[model samples]
Target: MFAGAGSNLSQQFNLPFWVGTFGCAMLTILVSFMDFKKITRVLGIFTPIIIVMIFIICAYTFVGKTYDYEALDTVAQTIKSPMPNVFLAVINYYSLCAISAVSMAFVLGGSVVRIGVAEKGGLVGGTVIGLIITCATVTLFANIDNVKDADIPMLQIVKNISPVFSFVYSLTIFALIFNTAFSLFYAFAKRFAGRNKKKLRTVLCISVTIGFCLSFCGFKNLVALMYPILGYIGMLLLAVLLITWIKEKKNILAENLIRKKMIHLAVKKYDEDLDYTKKDKALFHRLGEKSVVDTEEIKSEIKNFVKETGTENLKPSEPESQSQSSDSANN
Candidate 1:
């Protein structure tokens, strides 16, 4: 899956090295949504065995070679003969770097999830980080000449250390690869199933077969070409995310301002209406006091009419009658 996709991406992007890496990553994500439980089970059982095999092969090959044997001797000589502590140191260093990388990835994943960008950012960040670490480690420590010539530098490193260490290292590598492959396979399966069940089986078989064929090209060369391209793609995605977030923030701010203005207008209108009603009531009471008909009596009549008829009755058009009564009183 990785190789075919990587090659395709490389050709498409005109970046044979990094684009291919990005393609492999995309393929992995595409596969992760499939049968997770089954994939996990397979990986759990297969990883250790693969690692052991890798370690043994690497160890035997490196140790059997006269140059590598001399290289180990040279390393030993440089370090003033092999010490038990040296082996421990090497293991500790490997363990530290591996653990740190995994821990950082988890932290980054959690952060992206918190920011609501888990689907977009988390995958990109994780892939870029993974590629960076892989490439850096291979370039830095893996014997340059041997790495180019040999199938696996890590296996050689293991062989240089000891058969047991080599086995352990191989196991670790196998586990990592298995986990990655399974994740990709599962994603692809899930995606295919959701889209079309009838075609799912066919898609899975073809994808896996293609990926397996690509894997034979060896892991190191693939990583060398794929990592940088992925990093660049990741940067582009990050820029897009930032722009989107900014736009969303602006929209939210505008909406909030509109909401606030609406609320203020509603409250102001309500207050004005309340004041108007109060003034009208006071005027009504004053007019009632000066009139022949009591205000309370008029109100009682209106209420009674409303109760009987199930409708509001006016107090009667008394404006003209009140004016005439006042004039007559004046005369």
Candidate 2:
């Protein structure tokens, strides 16, 4: 999207940026609902090829066009002035917010997986945290007036701190872009894999190649073309996600209630008898109702209990009893 924005802004506030950004954003969301592992593997294989293509294009563009520092300065000056149309400014601002929010949602999704927090509260909390971080970062660094002229506004700020820091910042940016591209490729591959490794490879290679080719029309021009488009698409997706969440709230709550009840019932069953049949134990195991359980310790105790008392006589025990059994077994 940033690439698209840069592209569009370079071309005189045209439609291309909006189109590209929104299109890519929609594609990202569509790809995300897919199986991730397959997508990732395919991306892993295709990324090097894509990068090579992008490098070639960059080389070509750098040689073909004169560096337009003066034009860049003019653009910066134009953006510094008040936007002629108040409505357009409002729309642009809202679009920026939507893009930020959607990006936050993706970050939240990744963090939840990493931290093993898949609950509703976890999703909400992660999203909130992501938004806070994004907003704070933008507030700290985004100088709207100078943003128009800067090739890489955020990176420029880092350079001001130190050249070494700027170089590191550039590395980070490269890593992030590569990571996101690979992740996107992986997502697409998973969705379309269908047990055909050859087909998956082909599709991923093609997509990355296309993206790489597109990237070299000039990064800033591409970004200018993409961001507004993405912003609009993000706004739509946000509405849908919000509506779905609202509609499912009651059902989600009810499911959690059922899970809590099942946990309570399993704990009760453990109290009723010192010995439980394998089937009875399996019932509690299948319930897997652990909003907060020390699963590692539980697994260790279960393993020892199976080895010592045998699986046939294994019983669900209270948390304290479970701890005691584990300690005794270890001793």
Candidate 3:
């Protein structure tokens, strides 16, 4: 992203690529020192603008450009892919993108207090992203002959549309790149430095400087070499997470079963000990005399007991008489 942003700046301003690259790297380092809330605030401002610009660019291209259907299949077949299998290639690409956003997702998820809100956010976010990608892909493929050799294809497409659109879209693309770069580096620093502000700043300086030097490799070269490797690594990480989640769900189910059993035992004990006082009678009468045990009260008591004594000690004990009889029969 740093390389891509630098390329955008160089093309837009007619400046040396290194100068733009260095400027972007320094700006990113400065952003790393800002408070996380402020960083998110900056992102919040640009996100909607970028989204709108992307759709506009796509719409313009779709309206203005005509795709060569006959040539489309030929171009697609001739184009080289990082992965040989098309399905796996798509999976790898998406996995790489998911890995990039996973840390930010964690940060955002932490702030959500309600399951419903998180569910809605995830659904809407995924749908919008998918739509954007679909639009952009169709637009790009439509202009494949023009952009197959270009450094930044989307910029070329927008520039061809109009100078005004080109300028605005360039700024939007830069912001989009900055948003990604900032989030990635911020997450990296936070993961290693934890809550240590000083160490975080230090890591940011070193990492961004290293990244700037590496960006000298040029954008296309970096993408060609880096993305596929990251995609494979992301796939491995995703597999591990899926396995861990399955194991966690199994453990939760087992624990829930044990908890339910404990609650049932506790409820039976409570029902047996009731004195059948007026209060109990009134409760039974209100409940139609079908049952007197308050299952909810039993569940709450079991939860408290587990908190105090732990689940290891919550197993029901056998009756002493039953144990003695079993022992005599064995003898």
Candidate 4:
């Protein structure tokens, strides 16, 4: 992204490409030192700006431009895609995306107050990303002939609409690229350095320097070479996560079954003495739903309830025949 952003700026402004690259590296280093909350706030502000820009560009091209489905088909055949197949391309793209998502997930997971919040965040984030990708793909195919050979096709599309719009969009694109680089690099450095501030700074500097040197490999070429490889690694990560989740779910289901049986048995054992109501049963059912439950602890709790309520001395009512015999003897 750094390489692509810098390449675009250099082309648009007629400046040295290396200058833009160096600037991104310096900005990344400075931004990396700031608190994560500050960085998140900045990204939060730009996210809406990006969404609006993308929508305007897509809507404009679709409304104003001529639709050449025949030309699009021909271009699709003529152009050589980076991936061999569409399925592989999608997987590679998502895998590469998962790297950033996972990185931020780790960082932000700590601040989450509830599992529901995290789940909601993932849902909304995934939906937004899907919409953006779908719109971009539609726009690209809608104007395939025009952007087929362009390095940064989105910018080309915007530039056709207006140079001023192109310039503003370029700044937005740069901030987004910076956001990605800063997140990945910061996460890497934090992981390696742990809680050591001095070491983290050193790691960040070294990583950014190395990344800057690599940006000379031309944005397109680097993406073509690196993204798929990362995607494969990301697939492995995803597989591992899926397997772990399945195992955990199985364990949870087993625990729930055991808890249900235990609660039923405890309730039945004292049914004659203790008056267990619908509310009490609901409470016991809830205890079974927790992540962890101890049968022994539950038994002790039931015993304590019996003692506290004076149910321990309570006995089952005598049969009618026994009661009648006692009454006759007394008479």
Candidate 5:
């Protein structure tokens, strides 16, 4: 979060930019060495911490008096962006996030998506989550005058509640960063590690070293630069996905039609062959001797009749035995 390759320990006196980044990278390396079962248990810690942090922040803000009630009221009337801009932004943001979540689960490597959250049918909860965050953000807007120029506005807001609360927030941020780094780098290393435990450490070390050097570019600048590019790329990806889905559906429908036609033709052919056998045998019996009687010439007539009238319904049936009677022998 600090602008440099690492945290600015001299200025912040806590987690400097470089130290925090490197720390996360180190934790990621540690996680790569761990077996999957251990990783699941490790992930279980993130939810509780996030829940507690959000509840704490929400509770404090709800109880505290707004610094400027007028600014809070004005936020309701303010137009942050044009309606089209907002619609596209929301669509692009959530779709990209969903894709990233899927990709990460895939990269974790295995049949099971270990870190994936199984979604329930309803999405009403997502609306509630948004409302809660937005309400707090609106409240913060009332005090934006105080933090408009600060490096971390939330820190300033939390510190105002209590220094103790600020420290707790700090620790929460640390845990979140470490968890993110661990998941990402573990996935990255796993791809190249390829079941070679001996080479994993070396690969992880190389990844960390490269990342540590990149930290000098500054996190804030990198985020500012990448976001617009990523958004455009995400939109393009969504378009491609939609087109592919449409093509697949069309192909499936065409295949189904072809299959049905083939099945109908096969059934009709079977009926024609059965009718011809019946006619030929009857002619043979008429002469009172076994003889070849061809009925193939009438095949087209049977087919035309079937086409106009349609076939009978098919069902499973048992064979019925026929007994030769004295009347049949005379014929």
Candidate 6:
């Protein structure tokens, strides 16, 4: 971040770029070293807060200003490159601008982010809300000043309304920058932190200092170089994630279909033997009952004949009813 680089404070105080750069980066360093989970959650809310502030500021501008800007404020005067397609041009602008802005939804663990995202109708829904808010903000700020030469156009807009407003807006800007800076630096430092507390602090300082030094290269230059590269990287990551999601869904659907087919086949075989399953209830009770009754009489006859004959081998305690019951149970 440029921090207070082109703000009213820097201009009034005649501060050097290095001063603002180092100050912001150093604050970010302290933020990185903080072991506070509450701080992360608090900082996480800052982006939404920032967006709300933007909406508030936009409303103030609408109510405060009666006259229109003589001309639209253009942030970039020199259009070094141009795209022909209108849709693509808009897409390109947002893709670059959103690099850090949209990092809030990410940066946390993906699963946790997904859980949080679902309540707001998932990631795409949140994005649409963000876009609507962004469009309103752009419409207000684009005409903040007609004189496009000022590096800090928003500062001039608020200043025109009131010094009090300007000062408050400036502080808001600083807070937003600080919040964003904390996230970025902390993310970079946390990677190397692992379990080394002492080493992590040293690395964190060095990293912040290095970032401060890098900031001297100027925010405009960095944005110019970094945005396009980040845009492509973001696109690639999105493509990979979408493709993987599609593949996973396909696998799940395939497994479900196979399972259904197996169940269907098993049911078909069961249906074929449905007649056999109902043998005792359906067929045996009707047709086989008389034959079964005839067999009992025949068994009684045999038992009586065996008893009447002097058969020493057959014990009197041995019952033919037990044998017949066993046969019926087997069937």
Specify the highest-TM-score model's number: 4
What global local distance difference test value does model 4 have?
0.73
- Those runs of model 4 whose alpha carbons end farther than 4 Å from true positions after fitting are 64-66, 249-331
Q: Write the per-residue lDDT of candidate 5 for residues 1-331, one digit (tens) a residue.
A: 2233144231235555567666666666777677865786677586566666666666677675545577755653453332246567666565554444444455432322111222221144356546555655654665566655444556667778787767766666666656655555555666788668768678877877776667668765655565445666777776876798587776545433332322233233556433334533453334322212123423333344345455554211322101112222343
Query: What's the true lDDT of residue 97 in model 5?
Result: 49
1-331 in candidate 1: lDDT tens per residue? 3553444333333455445444455445544545644555565575445534544444454464545555644544443212246565444444444333343344333322113344455466556545555544533233544443343444554455565665555445534544565454544554557546546656665776676666657455655555444444555555675798687886545433332222222222234332224433444344434433355654343334334433212121357435533532342
Rank list by TM-score? 4, 3, 6, 5, 2, 1
Q: Model 5, poorest ten-residue lDDT window?
A: 113-122
Error of 3 at 250 (Å): 7.9
**3 or 6, greater by lDDT:** 3
lDDT of 3 by residue, 83-137 (tens): 8797888788888988998887776654442234565898998898888888888
- Model 1 TM-score is 0.36
Looking at model 3, residue 246 earns an lDDT score of 89
Per-residue error (Å), model 2, residue 14? 28
The true-versus-predicted C-alpha distance at residue 205 of model 2, in Å, is: 2.1
What global local distance difference test value does model 2 have? 0.48
Q: Which stretches of candidate 6 lie over 4 Å from their true place?
A: 3-14, 62-86, 101-106, 110-137, 140-147, 195-200, 248-331
Task: Report the lDDT tens digits of candidate 2 across residue range 188-282.
Answer: 65457744766766676667556645765667555566656765676677688789989988765654543433333344344454444565455
lDDT of each: 0.45, 0.48, 0.71, 0.73, 0.52, 0.53
Question: Per lDDT, what order, best first?
Answer: 4, 3, 6, 5, 2, 1
* Per-model TM-score versus the true fold: 0.36, 0.49, 0.72, 0.74, 0.57, 0.59
lDDT of 6 by residue, 103-161 (tens): 54344532131132334544665585566557555644456444344445566666666
How much lDDT does candidate 1 score? 0.45
